[model samples]
Target chain A: MTSLGGDRSIGRLLASLALAVGGMGAGAVWAPSASAKPPAPAAFCQTYPDSKSCTTGFAECATCHTTAPARNAFGAQLSERLAPGTPRPLSDQAFVSALPSALKMIEGLDADEDGFSNLAEIRAGTRLASAESFPKVMACAPDQASKSGDGRWNVCGYDPNYAFRKISLDFCGRSPNRAEAEAFRKIKGEAAQKAALGEALDRCLVSKYWLGSNGVVWNLANAKIRPAFVIKSGANPGPVPLGDYDDDYNLFTWAHSGDRDVRDVLKAQYFVRRVSDDPVKLEIIPEEEVKKRGRATAQPVPADKRAGLVTTRWFAASNTMFTAIPRTTAAQAYRAYLGWDIAKMQGLLPVSDEPHDYDRKGVGAPECAVCHTTLDPLTYPFTRYNGIGGGYTYDDDRLKAYIRGDGPNVVNAPKSGIILGKPVKDLVEWADVAANSDPFAMNVVRDYWKVIVGREPEVQDEEEFSRLWRGLKDPARYNYRVERMLHDLVLTTAYGRP
Target chain B: MTRTAFIPALALVAAMFAAGCSSLPSAGSEPAQVASIDPKVKFKDGDRYLGDLARALNMPRETVCKELGRYDCFSDAFRIVLGGVEAPNLTVHTPLEEAALTAPIALDRAALHVCTSRVRMDREDPANAVLYRASASGRPDKAWMETTSNELYGVLLNRDPTKAERARLVGFYKDVATEQGKPNPDAASDWVTLSCFALASSLESIFY
Candidate 1:
């Protein structure tokens, strides 16, 4: 149940701060005072040039700093050395005078006390603030050393040839041919063999089998919910086949195949569809037009209306029930997108004392409000979107009927909602909040880690997991490119070992 | 009746009895001492196994699938039942019923049909000239059998057979040839048939 382990407590604390300071705006709350004497930018920048505060990239200071003045362990250490204030242009002399002391102070400190020194963590591109984040240094058993004194087999515990075969089957969905196997075996020396194996993995990632058949992209999507054209029929009519589901699959395949940013899954303004021809070409359609096409044709929706996979017809159909205001839809979104299941109260949101009833009373009552406080508000924006039967519509009357009770005037129905304690007027704002949230990135990393390692990442893996997450978020490195993430994963000790 | 006529009838009956006895093993005799080959290889599921088979045989997957009766051979034979509601790519995660009653039966039937067809198609083709030569060499010697066994092992198991294994398989081939009779014109085809069966039904061939 505790997937994140002891780090969950720390994560909970950050979540609380994020929610409590939600209204103040992330930048406003985190930004240091402008009037205070600014730090020597050149000194900090020169030392940790790749740090977000020092660079203009996706992974910035805010990644670790939930609030700037109140920094996390990593941020605090940096702030102490660099001088606590907003970064500003400083003279070279002033920068040089401050650089040595700050660097010296953090040199030997294990800020999070995860055993790894701050310098080691920084050099390894691991998080210094989180005890959970550290490099995994694998130790080999003494008996495993080869006669030739090559420790490769000792570390990996798998014959390079067998490892290559397994990697090919797992990544490419088939075994290597005789020629391919021979070519791989012909490579002499452990280093050369390892390099060749890595190159083979890279080639497999782009193979037709990986792209079309048993590829990671499709498997990742399937793991969430099987891409279905129709749900089974019982008392209610089965959800009809919407061409959009196939479009969703094609879009995912295209993104991953192209090695494009995977964050576009939640943030892209267009959906891709393959044209029916001898040599098919994928076309991107706008969100509004896609909605108008319904299940009749494949097209893109307008940028503002699109919410990546969340707004897809298949997603809505799979998650929603017959009822108009499908609370399950919101719950699924929270679990899938944010990586926290509301039913389990994983986020540990505060409970307030109030009376209970189904008519607003239940939502506000102290006992019921424990979960509904977050659940109801989170579901408010979803009321605009109807269930499977309604398809994808923005009709106000349909929205009203859905939120209100079917028979009567339900004045108690929520008119607005909050996401991670941030107020959202409607689903668009909700999507924006969900898309840019830290939980979104963390969830993605968690999912990918599971796919690559074939197991749920334990608490011990939090440091490496965070590094992967940071890389995905950092536009400078991978930037939400899943292929790059997969490449990184294949090269990990976990992937190489049994 | 004449004594000559009676003697001729007795001789004809003796010849028939002798032929029948030759076909059957002697009473209290042990079964043919066939070598037991256990590669300790586990079975791959339908898709992977079929893909491997097609690649190793240099045949199109569609042809192999069709010859094996498609789903019956690949899915039902392997117990990968694709129910009406099941997705095509949804892998059945249950452990394969390697010891199930029907497993051997199904494997035998499919391997016999496919391997026979593959041998028949390749026998006359120049591409399989080595296989044809080995089969048609009248009587296989130790060196030839060893070479053939190694080649077959490479194709099926992706490795060379050990000296003991090659010797055992060659002994099997010799026994098969001797049982078919020396003057049998179909001796080559029968040898190839048994060899194909051995490769196809092998633990190495069935498993990864």
Candidate 2:
């Protein structure tokens, strides 16, 4: 048999073989009991004095005899004396000792019947009423229901079947701020307006309170989209519904821990205009929506070799790696290029048998190495961060903990591999490090900005994107700018593209 | 082609003008042909629809169809332009493009009035309800309705605003509740149709 090494990666096979050796040691030394023989031995031992062989004393003559009935009877009596102490009484030890050949006879009858001697059972806790009499086992609770309705918000109520899909929003019941409400109240012939306002108020009340009541149900149904990374961390990361365009808008609750980041993207501050300002003005310009419209292009990897081009491996699900939004061409390009780099870092480029020495949090190195031996290009961009706050914050500790080799708790682990030589604790730091070292970061931002806003990133625009990415390096801008960024993104030509 | 485009634009403007003056579509008079209008027809989305449906049913739009379902692109557009609700089932009596087209004009208008009046009153403005004289005949157990409205309002207020569109559908049966409350024989006659409309539109009655 081939010998196995004791490396942590190879420990399971080694442990199994060692257990086999232990089994053989017990089987070789065990012996049978004297009580197993027939009572005919009694006749033989009793007749010994009458037979020619009995001419000598029976104890002396019986040395060559295989069958001795009187000796067998003595052996049984001696064995009884050695039986283990129980709650009940047994014959006296003195009576047992009076039998001839007591020591040898008692040794043949094994108590406890474990491969080990009775003394060993006493030492080991294995000795009990009987081996068949099982120790009590505790029963486990039933599987936790995802949709338990005992929640304050209808959204919190559990439904194992509803997957995250079809989110919607309405401003019903929440009249505009005081100024707006007062202004509307002043319209004299405003019956229509008043009615409209009432409707809006009702919509607001429902959307704000009841929209996501079934989120747990939806999440449970679509387990794959259940934000696996967030769930593993033991934190209440809020909920995500998984379905494609079943509802108007994707509704996320304010109860979300990542609300700040989401708000930043919406640019929900006073400075930014409401999305509903000019309803008729909304138009989709598809061609102008190309990724990174005017941004610098990412270094291209050949198509055939581009399979391993994804850079952010923080969260990949269903075996497909991606980003939340790869709105820009540069972002997409960098994703492709970095994906290949990651594959190389993991020794997938040379197609070697050796595993990559990635940190404990990485996904593709050892975890995915067994499947895809070669590099593959990234097909999508990294737009959404699946970690604790908002999207990607770029914190060093968080990033390190995520892609370090061992998986982070399910909440923070990135399914894809990390960029080589870049400093990434969280998404924000990654942006900073990318700005300084990976020219690709700048490219991604520029392209994404242009795509989202439907306008080319001018000097000011480029400067702002760079500044946002850089300022966020300190992590302050991570969750705060989601609203602004989202508002800006939707305003871009890139946002309208397929 | 330009002339044809101009004609459609002119028609739309004319339609709007006509709509503003209450030169309403002859309820049920138009043949019930299922012509496919743009899904984005103005006033068909979420709160607008709920509001109109509530008004037609003589109930509070806000208190009834409080949650507006998801506003699709079309629905959003419809919401922005919606003017008022009419009880069209009383006049127009044919199943046209969608259900609304099939309704009679008088019935639709009546429902719309009721919804608007009641909703305006429900919004912490008891004076509005008093002014509209929108009292339920036979003294609808005012306390029960009040309690129900309060419960619904609390649920509505605390809910995430984004889901307002979808959740508003819970008021689908507002007409039924209002009909049960109304003491007037004339109003009660039309209550069943109004209630059916409300029930059909609610999120709870539909998707939920």
Candidate 3:
């Protein structure tokens, strides 16, 4: 007969997505007129240095180009104001210098016509180009504040008591039993209670429900790995298991747990084996042992060729499949590990005069060229890594081996490619560039943010989200340990409040 | 306004955004106060919900909720609807972003299953029973329902029911008595079973 108490919003749950909220930043030294000039993304941040979109150091490509070369309403407006009468394809310097004025010129206009002006949208961290992606107006003010049960709850701020209940359920995977709940309520000082929450997290972080086979952290890899049980090789091997994804899961779990380095998920040269499931223990397996013990479906990418989860046999087999240009493979690695989705027009760093369409996939057409310019070159390094037929191994002849079906033009695929507007010699360098990138830190932090906070960082959450990710990459704070970062995260006003 | 603006907070220290990757969102114009109402991050997933029930009932998890007495509800029947992932087999890498419509129905079925299963076990051996402390052989008194509510609430919610909640359960007992017409010997058992269902499937029981 008791009332069931819960809100009715169906928001992101259990951290299963890689939502493409892309912003780009790359190494210095790319000249003003470098390849694919008019870095609209970069110039955007320079113009609106305090724009919410600039928090991560760049704006999403969607802010200007619908799919690069095709400007959105905001970009179209900016185009009209940018260096008027200066011929098409203005120099990067001209565009960069003129960007502020162009942005200011259009500030009064409602680019998306969502009522909010372009400047307001940019400041609100809403999409200036998309009508649906606008900031929510404050509907309720503090004077009209909703009342709490006992009047003791900080209705306007982080409530440690509420946060303790949340942390217990989220991390420990259950509500505290009556005795434990009562004991938490009995803690005297707020600092002591907050300290108790940390201790509880320490205990729960090691629980089986968190690190076990189907545990919360393990499932966080589901969207990234996209495991298919039918073709799975290890643990619950399918009928025709080709390769095991558990290795991929093990490496992911290891990278995110304990005193581990999260960068290892992208930069690890060694494979991790889940040594124990209960009180989960994962250790790096030496290359020699992995090689000698290799079954046909064993982790096929040799230690020297491995790039953490990106180079896992299952990752290559599932995403790359069979293709002359393994654009899907490269895109998945970028989307999954780096949190950029080219499909969503995110993380675009267009290489100039690109998408040679070497395999003749018709990507040279203007409609396709915008993203392909960035995507095709981004895919070049992945082309050298074979798909299903090649056991996902690195092969100099991978392109040549596919020429029979894809034609000899496939062999023209480049071994070097571009990532974040910077050139990389190969996928190994590509992973390294991505792993150390600011986006990688932001993306990793965003993953946990979404998991614990139960939603994407809203305009209100930007400051907290920014601090958490920044601290994650800061050696002085967390030293890149996700566990350490989480300590600061649970303390964030966003996570602790509501 | 921005909900945390009124709170004592860490000063916003913007990381120079040390470059080398595509990113987004910088400190934009402080638009306005973000509403005090943050989105509700509620709803326990199936694993946690079912696990909580199993732990509270002092029953083996396998006996908690079996669809058709065979399949595990969390792993099978209500798996996806209740927020358990079945990846690599179904490609459902993540749980549904929101609780599915059938989620509440699945939750009810799972909760009822565990509650009834516990009642059945306790009825078979009342001397060693964890619930139904008093015999459910006849019409229950108000005092008995109060004790039952506390036990049920403590077992599932880990806290005693409020006075209002106790009053509601007691009111429901009268309705159960009327449905019996005659003083059915099974009225007390039926009342206990129904009361357990109400508490086990309550929203507070399901969501965090």
Candidate 4:
């Protein structure tokens, strides 16, 4: 058996193997020479920056290569310099030595021709390879002061009326009513108008309309699963309408209301459900009653089995594959809470001979071990939570029985699992671990930014994104209160712009 | 008519009316469809559109709902599908093409079915008629028509119409009335159609 070192090693092996196998049976005899060896890893900019290090936010390998060997313009340029001779692989040492000259060669070049040089683009945290991803160059006169109504500044500059419209529409799910619009127009100066707009935003954030059917907050939260509420169980089982799971929306609305910390979405002890007679009124109950009364009854889940939304029926139903504790549940939780995909991160880890039962015999071979080693362990703690039953169960007896009869031949089936490289004993611990993690904070900031800014947070927006992330997690500032974070987001220069 | 023939006929009528209105352009000239609005521009979605229209027109929510049968009529006209599944209601983002293509036709049909019905009901009651009231002399004049247009624009578009826009609309009303011939008892009906077209087809009415 051969050991697969990692993604880079496997990629190199595949490249060499392709070359070796190409000339075979074509009257060309190929022999393995003693001097021949697998090429060393490319010294990617992040791992081996030249004399001037790649700037902040220029950290991921994806910055150059969309994925290795599939080079973006910047990556293509580097490839041309480092492996110019018939596309031969460059060793790590060779790559490191070649990088300095390669970097100097492309310093002033505008690869994508979006008006910024490669070095300037890298420093500005803009993508050098994509014209669409370059830094936004707003045309402004030298004398055009910030926030002035000169009309010289491009849409990137603050516009009071535009910002007001955005705030009302994004936060309240409607255009400003006539009274509000007139009031905004009545304000005399830009400063006064901005102050009034801020006040209006505060009111909109707490208004019942913000928590209503068309609310932006509700829409953003719902985008994760967009649960169908009804499921066709399997052959002959018929349709199962989990109308009770509508409580998930109610719980989200409640958690975001008033001074409630949005983090309570993961940490709240109780869940909320709409009153049957009046769909508007909601009742909160402890988590323990969820199993006995169903999620529609607004009940509490037991402490050991609870992890806020993760253990909720809607989340489980939507994310899980039927009849088992699917790794999909863990992956969704990671994405929803931590803003990272385990599958995407697989390339960063070295391959192992670890066993993962779900993978077919040859599928989990060393070449694919990078993802399973992390993903399988992460899903171990979730085994206690039954997928089809629509509730949590501490008794692993059923899980053990399922594993024996029908589940994967997962070795060691540890009681504890790992998250973001830290060990978590159970689903509850997983929530706590995630709730306090930086990625979770960043994810919250990123989601809210996307909704408020009306666009994806690009690398050009990284500085502001980091600032917002820090402000949100900072107890002295927003203290993880989502309302305050949202307020701060609207006040940011980016949100105020057209 | 066969379903295929009916669809093409409807498309032809829609295209003709859209071209007739110089203010409203064809959908083909619009940019590529985006899943989200620019926030700086773009019209409100269905919920806000219906809710605001109900408020501006002083029409009851139930009356609007009754006229526009839930998902089959107006909602289907502007609905968006994602990955072969219909997105949740109120989450559908109408691109410019869909809005331009569907809004005029849907609003016109709605005006014919719903607004015309409301005007007929108002004519009988006279007391609760928000659009038109019984005149002492029972005569339609330029002043009354201008006041009516201003009131409609104020309520629907939330801004007074420009001098040029108001003149164009007034000319449109006269043209439409002449086409129907003089002493047309349906002059009020003509005004109703003009009001609906002016308000619903205007960029201000469509975009926030």
- For model 4 the TM-score comes to 0.75
Deviation (Å) of A337 in candidate 3: 0.6
Best of the two (3, 4) by lDDT: 3
Q: Report the number of the highest-TM-score candidate.
A: 3
Question: Model 3 — TM-score against the truth?
Answer: 0.83
> For candidate 4, what is the DockQ-based docking class?
incorrect
- Maximum-lDDT candidate: 3
Model 3, B1-208: lDDT tens digits are 1223211110110111111001211112211223335545577888888888888888888768899889999887888998888887788887788778888778867876787788878889888677676735554677777888788778877877656566656666654453324544555665666667776766567765
Our model 2 lands, by Cα RMSD against the true structure, at: 30.1
Clashes of 2: 155
For model 4 chain A, where is the 10-residue window of minimal lDDT? A2-11
Q: Give the local distance difference test score of model 4.
A: 0.55
Per-residue lDDT tens digits for candidate 4, residues A1-498, read 111111111111222222222222111222221122112122334443431113221244454666543678887776666646634555545656676677677878888787777776655545567786554433343343332343322353556776787787666656666777777777889678867887878877765556664355555566554545344221222256442445566677766666677676777667776554222355676545555674433223465566677776666666653544467888777766766665664212221233355423343544444456556666777776655454434455535545554545433465576655555787778788778765677778777775567455553354576688778788998788788777767766667765
Candidate 2, residues B1-208: lDDT per residue as tens digits? Answer: 1333323422333343234224222222322222111111112233434543344334544454322333321223232222221111112111122334423332333333344445445444645432122335543344433433333322322222222222332232233333234533333222222323333333322121
For each candidate in turn, the TM-score is 0.62, 0.24, 0.83, 0.75
Cα displacement (angstroms), candidate 1, residue B3, comes to 45
lDDT of 1 by residue, A1-498 (tens): 111122222233233333333423432322221221123333444566654222221222332354332468765675566644626544445546766576668869888899978776655445567787665433333333332134212233435775687668666657787788888879899889878877887877766556653345555565344544354221222365443456566676666655676666666668776553223345676556556763444332335656677766666666764555556787777777777666654442332221122233344544445566557667766665545557555444554453355434333444456777566787777877876776777777777665455455543344566677678778887787777776666555544543
TM-score of 2: 0.24
lDDT by residue (tens digit), candidate 4, B55-172: 7667764465344455423345443321112323343322233334545555555544444555666677788876666554566677677776776667666767656556545555
